[model samples]
Target: MKHINREVGSLLTRIIEKREKFLRAGDHKDDLLGLLLKSNLNEVEVNKNSDGGMSMADVIEECKLFYFAGQETTANLLTWTMIVLSMHNEWQERAREEVLQVFGNNKPDYDDLNRF
Candidate 1:
């Protein structure tokens, strides 16, 4: 578990560093990391006399929380979906047919997902 935590921290640090480079170059994105960095910069600017903004570690921790939360939500969604499908054969068949019709023996495309 300690090794895993170190690995995750290292990865998040690398990601944050790369985003910081882009941010410094004026290539600001509206994504989560970008927004966090922007907010941190704003806070620092506002509180030039004190340490009032999130540190790199704090940003990484926030990212970790969001990452885990998203995974949990996705897992719960899939679990519930499977349970519902198992209980409703007709709905499951319809869903299967729709998927097959939309993507038969091929990888699904993002544009075609709206058809479902």
Candidate 2:
């Protein structure tokens, strides 16, 4: 567990570092990390005389929480969807048809997923 935690922490640190670089370069994104960094930057600016903003560790922790939470949510959604589809053949067929129609043997992209 400690090893896994260390690995995840290292990955998050690298991601944060890259995002910070982009932020400093004025190429800001509107994603969660970007927003958090922007907010932290603003807070630091506002409280230049004091330590008022989140540290790099704090940002990494927030990202970790969001990352795990999103994974859990997606897992739960897929599990329940499978269970329901197993119980309802009609709905399952409809869903399969929709997927085929939307994807057509190709990997589904974000925009195509929305249509599905």
Cα RMSDs, all models:
2.4, 2.4
What global local distance difference test value does model 1 have? 0.92
Q: What lDDT tens digits, residue by residue, belong to model 1 across residues 10-96? A: 999999999988888889999888999988988988999999899889998999999999999999999999999999999999999
Best by lDDT: 1
Candidate 2: residue 96 lDDT (0-100)? 90
Candidate 2 on 12-109: residue-level lDDT in tens? 99998998898888999999899999899889989999999999889888998999999999999999999999999999999899888877899988
Displacement of the residue 75 alpha carbon in candidate 1, Å: 0.3
What candidate 2 gets wrong by more than 4 Å, as runs, is 105-116
TM for candidate 2 is 0.85
Residue 65 of candidate 1: its Cα lDDT? 98
Best by TM-score: 1
Give candidate 1's TM-score: 0.88
Score each candidate by Cα lDDT.
Answer: 0.92, 0.91
Q: Name every residue pair that clashes in candidate 1.
A: none
